[model samples]
Target: MFNLDQAISAWRRQLAAGGIKTPEVLDELESHLRDDVEQQVRSGTSEEQAFNSATQQIGQTNVLKVEFNKVGLAKWWQLPIKLKGMLIRILGREQPFPFPDLNTFTPRGLQTLELAREEAPRLGHDFIGTEHVLLGLMKSEDGIVLKVLRKAGVDNSAIKAEIERFVGVGPVHEANMAIPYTPRARKALHLAAREANALNHVHISTGHIFLGLLLENEGVAGHVLRNLGVQTETTREAILKDLAGS
Candidate 1:
């Protein structure tokens, strides 16, 4: 008594429990699974056997979760702000949102993130904050971000000094240990992807990252920028101009 519908339902529940909770994503995965099973069945495999083979082909829950997460962020970025908020409310705060893959970032953009990660430990902090991201943007040379900052009369060295002063130094942690992003930092990155998408860019760039930091204007980076007399609108315009030119 192999009940195909019941078995698919059970499989969907398993995926949900394994962190594939988005309804749209779940539906898409289920569709793929069904297609695979149907193909096998058409080729003469028993229905139950086809089901098992399809599940195997779909991949383990953990691997599927990671792949879906990578796709999720891009899809999330395309969502309108209001729709995103509504979806967030429906999903609740208990589930962790998926972040985009670093591979989507351009070389200089990836460098900024890496420098931010390194800056956290160098500053004796165990977590990467928006402030660290600011520092990383400053440290990155020859990037359009630095060019925009220079055009805006913002001194990179001064910004770095200010961030260090604001954050201060925490107790030392192991350099090799992975540091997680603070909520603000994560939001900034999400905004960065959104910024790139708005411009119809396929890859996230350093300028987009800077714009992300600026958009998260209540964060430490925003506070420091304000203290330095840097206007968010002006800086945003400058970054946009640079991006357009390049």
Candidate 2:
């Protein structure tokens, strides 16, 4: 008695009410829901039962709507499309710039900052993106990158306290500050710059930082990226391919 099509239609309406307005993103979400419902139906559940089960397993649509809204501006994992919009407002033109703050950066993040300075103006942007923030932390002398490094496996405060004992200081820099870069780090910065430019994206996003780290491909930074389940070559290639088609 459960009408699968009816249920999906209702869910789509729910998403729209919650401000998930992009048709493309909605289509992908719908496809996922349909796949879930079909799997439940194939497992011998009645249509109604399958519908109910699939919907429940998918969690509340309202909550998902909230998550989608938070994705671009608030989420640390990915830069929201608002960045592109902001750039458009600034330039008074239609152009896409990546958001920079979303980088899951380590020490190598500083390189991203240098790259941004070199590239942001070229992209005709006045401000940097979240990806740049991530890179700034990594390259900053502010001891943030070190904190992230030590805190990777355990409590961050504990690592800082231990470091203070050796350095006789709270931390080398404040949490929101960026550190200076060395020649080697500068070279890493250039690589990130080149990669961003090659992508033709006006601003950088966290995804770009992932690519930068992969291009660096060394030491602790690379190891952390591997653990994070980032497939550098594959993701880079996929982004490039998508850009090409677009």
Candidate 3:
């Protein structure tokens, strides 16, 4: 008389709270649970016994959280959007940048994102944020973003060394794991497109991304840049100066 479907649904709810929210992982777990239940039942175990055995074999919630932490699927979606937007505006001393679909990243701009993905794990962070993007830009070595940051006294080695000191060793990112962007990072990207469009530029370039980071000034990336004396207006002017010369 055990309701297997109900039990599974309840288990799923519990799993989600423990950070096992990815549909792919949860679905596979449920499938395996069903198979385990069937096998146990056929071996003369009662329905409830089969269910308990399957649940036990599926592992505890804390263990699953540890196992899946590398996938970078944690609880960042819990942030309050309205408050976040307000804070972003206040921190930057300007209105929040309107959302823009920034689809055009120059080859190097695209490469910057790839570099960000790499930096996220190295920093032991579960999510890719504006800080990671900034780190990525810094890691580029010879790109325009790096050059600008360097010119402004934002020392790469110093920043990297300092930021690492502040953050503790966290979740180890798994290979090929899909990492979700933090809200501010996503907002920064959209603002990058806005920066391009505002300047009548055809392509979203790395310079525009710098503008995005500046505009989305509430994120950790903005904070780090500010600490380095990279104010938004000043950085924007520098980018404009570069754009004008080029």
Window of ten residues with lowest summed lDDT in model 1: 77-86
Please write out the lDDT profile of model 3 over residues 1-246, one tens digit for every residue: 679899999999999988878776677678768887998899999888999988886678777666545322233222332222222322333324443443577777777788888887776564667877887777764367677777888788867765565444444655235655666788898888887888888877778888888898877777777776776787788887886565
Assess each prediction's global lDDT (C-alpha) against the native.
0.75, 0.46, 0.70
Q: Give one digit per residue, the lDDT tens place, for model 1 in 86-176.
A: 3333343343434567888988888888888888777666566788889888887646877767776878788988877765765454554
Q: Across residues 13-121, which tens digit of lDDT does each residue of candidate 2 receive?
A: 8878777767766675676567767877788877787777766755576755655555324222222222232222323222333323434233334464655454333
What residue runs in model 3 are displaced by over 4 Å at the alpha carbon?
Answer: 1-103
In Å, residue 67's CA in model 3 sits off its true spot by 21
After superposition on all C-alphas, the RMSD of every candidate to the true structure, in Å, is: 14.3, 17.4, 10.0
Winner by lDDT between candidate 2 and candidate 1: 1
Q: How far is candidate 3 from the true structure (C-alpha RMSD, Å)?
A: 10.0
